[model samples]
Target: MGHDKSGINNELFFGEKNAFSKKYEAILYNESKALSPSAKVYFNQINAFLAMKKGKADLAYTHMQRIRVLYSWYPEIKENNYNEYLRSNRNLCIVLMHQKRFEEATEVIDQLQKP
Candidate 1:
């Protein structure tokens, strides 16, 4: 599904909390790889967001890791452009903080300071 039809904004803003969010996230994850990489990144981001909304910090971290790995790979070259996943890192910090992992959260936050 395209961004216009992804329903991400609607679900985040209007949809009530319930079991269906997991089903929706699962559907996105199950989509064929023919979906562009960037779109997959967005879908994983949505997964992390929904997981956090449901207080599933561990699952959200997993989603963030997936996005991070994808962003670290270069399409035409081999390089780890880690900053490309800074949003995911921020989300990771949030998730860690929610889990009461203060030290780990600080470590994740420190990544933002890298120049």
Candidate 2:
């Protein structure tokens, strides 16, 4: 039988947190070798999420820097996928807040609120 999408979603939703780490890491490592610009942004975001989850604020910030660098070359991100961008931005803001970088977190939130 084919893989069950619902089962995969359920596992992702409520199973072990690191359940997808290996897959994500492999994809990220391979993508890094290929240097796919789009993949780099996603890899950085996933790394940042993992770092944040592990209470590694500094590492998360470094990954966030990668994202910022990627975004700097494309200022029209808000017009591309505003909802997804806002979601990712919000997650970063939360991580920054955990690290007590209130100013930076506030800036992200402000940007997300903009039209």
Top candidate by lDDT? 2
Each prediction's TM-score against the native? 0.62, 0.64
| RMSD per model, one decimal | 7.4, 6.1
Instruction: Give one digit per residue, the lDDT tens place, for model 2 in 8-103.
Output: 553354334456755556665543553655567778877787676566889888888777777667656535755756666777787788888999
Task: Kindly list the per-residue Cα lDDT of model 1 for residues 25-113, writing each as its tens digit.
Answer: 55666625427676667777887887776678898888887776766663321134344466567787888788888998897677657
How many residue pairs clash in model 2? Answer: 0
Clashing pairs in 2: none
lDDT of candidate 1 vs native?
0.67
**Candidate models: Cα lDDT each:** 0.67, 0.68
lDDT of 2: 0.68
State residue 107's C-alpha deviation in candidate 1, in Å: 1.7
Worst 10 residues of 1 by lDDT: 74-83
For model 1, what is the error of residue 51's alpha carbon versus the real structure, in angstroms, after optimal superposition? 1.1
